[model samples]
Target: MAAPHDVPSAAQLVAAVRDFLADDVLPAVEGRVRFHTRVAINVLGMVEREIELGPAQAAEHERRLAGLGVADDAELAAAVREGRFDDSALVEALRDAVGAKLEVANPGYLGDG
Candidate 1:
């Protein structure tokens, strides 16, 4: 379904551009231009996924941070820098942050975690 605005919501717009680059532009280009077009398409694909997943990921991130008793990443990092986190908390925080990033940057890179 279209958004309440009636047409081409942000994710839809991103997908349209990504499809255009991959389907139309990729087939017609060659060498360096093709490589760059492929990169652009991948970037747009990431944008579309981010549009869809970023909100939920952000909420989860905040929740995880709260569980660690911090407000945001800076606090968590500062604690880590000061050797505040125990081994388990340090590992968990790092894993959650990296996992959230992979969910946007490259889900394929993630393991069963």
Candidate 2:
């Protein structure tokens, strides 16, 4: 969907800052500052990915929750803890949800390499 705003949308702005920090500011920092800068860069990356994927992921999550007859993740967790559902389908659905989250959080972590 086209952003209902001008150029340099939220994701673009975040990407710009993240790139600036990584390519310029990061190299100049040391010790704790460098560590914190790295952390900030990671956070900005997550924010950018979230901006790109959050809506679709949220819709899919709601659909998956409905499929499992649960209103939300907390209820799903409760059902799982109580052994109310146990099946391959359930496992796959839960895995898919986790994978979607990983995509936003850190896609590299899911890489085969």
Candidate 3:
């Protein structure tokens, strides 16, 4: 998608700030400032991941929900609680959906880093 405004689109601007916080601000800060900087950096990282993966994740989530005979996560959860489907495939699909979420939220948890 072409940016009609100018150079440095929103994602670019976010990336720049995130990088600055990680590379410069983080190094100089201490105690609460450092902790908050880390949190801010993580939030920025999640934002970047969502910007990159949110659409694909949404489509995959919908597809997985349909495969499990549910329209959304709530329905899926209800079905799971009710034991409507007892199959490894359902479990695997749910696992994959969660894995996708973790990938966006914290990829390091899966040792992706």
Off by over 4 Å in 1: 1-4, 111-113
Model 3 alpha-carbon miss at residue 42, Å: 0.8
Instruction: Give each model a TM-score.
Output: 0.89, 0.90, 0.88
Give the candidate number with the greatest TM-score.
Answer: 2
lDDT of every predicted structure (CA atoms)? 0.86, 0.93, 0.87
Off by over 4 Å in 2: 1-4
What C-alpha root-mean-square deviation, in Å, does candidate 1 show against the real structure?
A: 1.9
Candidate 2 per-residue C-alpha lDDT over 4-110 given as tens digits, one digit per residue, 9 for 90 to 100: 88888889999999999999999999999999999999999999999999999999999998998999989998999888886886898888999999999999989
Tell me the deviation in Å of residue 60 in model 2. 0.6
Best by lDDT: 2
Candidate order by lDDT, decreasing, is 2, 3, 1
- RMSD, each candidate, Å? 1.9, 1.7, 2.1
lDDT of 2 at 10: 88
Model 3 pairs in collision: none
What digit string (tens of lDDT, one per residue) describes model 1 on residues 1-113? 33467577889989999999988989999999999998998898888888898988889888889988889988988987898777897798778888878888888889675
